[model samples]
Target chain A: MTTPPLPQWTALARDAVFTDPTEMLLKADRFDQTIRRRNWREYAAGVSGVLLSIGMAAFFAWVGDYAIVGAVMVTGMGFLVVMHNLRRHASPVERLPEEPCIEHLRRQYRYQAEALHSVASWYIGPLVPGFLAMQAAIFWNAAQDRGWEEALTDKGWPFALIVAFLIGVIALNRWAARDLRRKLAALETLD
Target chain B: MTQAAEALYRQAGAQFAPALARLARSVERDPEKARDLEQEMHCALWISLARFDGRCALKTWVYRVAHNVAADHVSRAVRGPQRVALDVIETLPSAGNVEAETAEALVLAQVGELIRRLPPVDMQVIVLWLEGESAADIADITGLSAGAVATRVHRIKALIAGHFQSEPAYGVTA
Candidate 1:
């Protein structure tokens, strides 16, 4: 069947209409719903991580008798959560503008790109001090149990591996940031 | 749901619900997903009302919000490299004032199928054009220049002409 002439589409377009969004509009705390829907997966991951850390922290406190270190980890997590919540509530993401769809898209890409680029600071950096203190506590405990030289010999490679892994993570985040920058630049060029 | 924001949202929603639904249909082939996208688009529109600020026409703002939400949904739901975000589009009413899905339903279905095959950018421009938006309006909504909208409209006309070598029932004579 051949389609109607172009001018006739406007009327036909109404056939597939969505009902008055009054219900949604009236009771729709849409931002809350949207934020919940969009970020639930991320929140799940975070909750799991927190639970695991709690287990680890308890082990450190009771088994390892590393109360100071355990306290640091738990407290740091609390601080991180509070900071995250505060920031999220303070300045929500603004909506898409009316200029053009492409511009709105690029703005979104740019936001994500910026977020990924700053992950080390907002996401990871907060944990660093606590983690380093924990590491030091572990070494101190190990050294007290074994002679310093023996502890150094025994733990040296593992410590070295961990430091290397952390470095690798930082490098990977940086690379991802650069990649996003390139993508954002390309999106800008399309305008 | 600040009262002011809700007031603006209700007004926009009433005025442009059709456009929002069509925008969702264009982006998503799956009906369920289209429904979800439509709701999400409405929600986005509501939350976004606070930022409208009278900078652009209300129609421009509505389409921009709807299309942007649709684009974002396509990326998130599809999880593929962003191939152009396009979808099926309807055509204009003739001087005869054809209802959107009258006897023309079959023809429109065919046109929708054809339009769906175009890249999202072209699909969007053609869809807007078909909806009787001015070239300037299409340009504003799609972020294309007037020249670019003209070019895409030209391509769409050619595409339709190819599909209907014989006379089309609704007067889309090439």
Candidate 2:
């Protein structure tokens, strides 16, 4: 059979009512409110983390565990650093929606890739000082109680596991960033 | 919203509202969900118009923002039906033929089915094409080169033709 004439696809919505400008603006305001609410939630979580870390550091210091206090203080600093990073990269500068789709998509991919690429510094590195201090405190305590040999024997596996987990996280982020960059490259060639 | 933005939105709503509704329907099958999607598109368009500097044609900007919102919606619906690439689209079964008095309605439904199965990029191209946009205009909206748009349009046409061929009794075309 010969191909029949195509229908006017726009006719499918011939009776579609144009939403009023006031209603549209209301919807836009609601959308903005939703985004603001989400941002507030993220801030709440980050603030809670910082406050908890600070409280922990203070308690540790009061108990005369200066080593743990140092570790806790470093961890508190880590929370602040992480919060800053999250806020910075939480969203890219809002671009005009009039921009071409490819450009918008590229921006999104680049934003993600950049965030993942710096995961080691902002995400992983911040915790390293605190992690090491805590480990050192444990090692010193065990060594004083028993001996360095027993401390190494007893704590070796746990230390190795922590190191392995951190490395794994960094490696995974690197792989994801690479993948996003590859997608970015592909999208670049699309237009 | 500023008066200027509201004025622009009114213009866009007056001009592209039907097309936008059809676009939402193309992406979302359920009527309730489609209406929600349409409202979302309207909301996005209204906000996006705040930055409208007349750098591009209003039609182009409206379509770009609406399609982007639809793409985001699809991305978030990870558990929804999976879309396919253009090359492999023909392998998928066509929509079951629905009996309607007018061949146009049937063809519209069939085309809608085809659109919903396509990846976002291809879906944008075909939707623009079916809405009577020129290849250059589609290129402007999608940021695809003119040649890329042409190539995709040709492939999409072939796929649509092939899809309809499988159901000869429909006496329909897209």
**Top-scoring candidate (lDDT):** 2
lDDT of 1 by residue, B1-174 (tens): 577766677677667777677767666767898888888777777667777778788788877777777766754663432343232233321213324454345446555554445544566676677666778888888887787778777767765665454645545643
Give the 10-residue window scoring lowest on summed lDDT in candidate 1 chain A. Answer: A1-10
In model 1, where do residues sit more than 4 Å from their true spots?
A1-13, A29-92, A96-99, A147-176, B1-16, B46-56, B81-126, B130-132, B150-174
Model 1 chain B lDDT-worst window of ten: B86-95
Q: What share of the true interface contacts does candidate 1 keep?
A: 0.42
Q: What is the TM-score of each candidate against the true structure?
A: 0.65, 0.85
lDDT tens per residue, model 2, A90-176: 765475556787777777778888888888998888788888888998888899899999999999899999999989998999899
For model 1, report DockQ: 0.28
User: What is the clash count for each candidate, in the order shown?
Assistant: 12, 0
Task: Write one digit per residue (lDDT tens) for candidate 2, span B1-174.
Answer: 898888888888788888899999989988899999998888778778888889888899999999888876765575755666676765334456556455446557777787887767788888888887888898999999998888888887776566557677644343
How would the docking of model 1 be graded? acceptable
Query: Model 1, A1-191: lDDT tens per residue?
Result: 12324544545446444434566655466556877875776666667767777777777667657655465675558555745743563353475445477676666667666665666666566666666676667677789899788888887888788778877787787787687577567545544
Which candidate ranks first by DockQ, i.e. highest? 2
Q: Alpha carbon lDDT of residue B152, candidate 2? A: 81
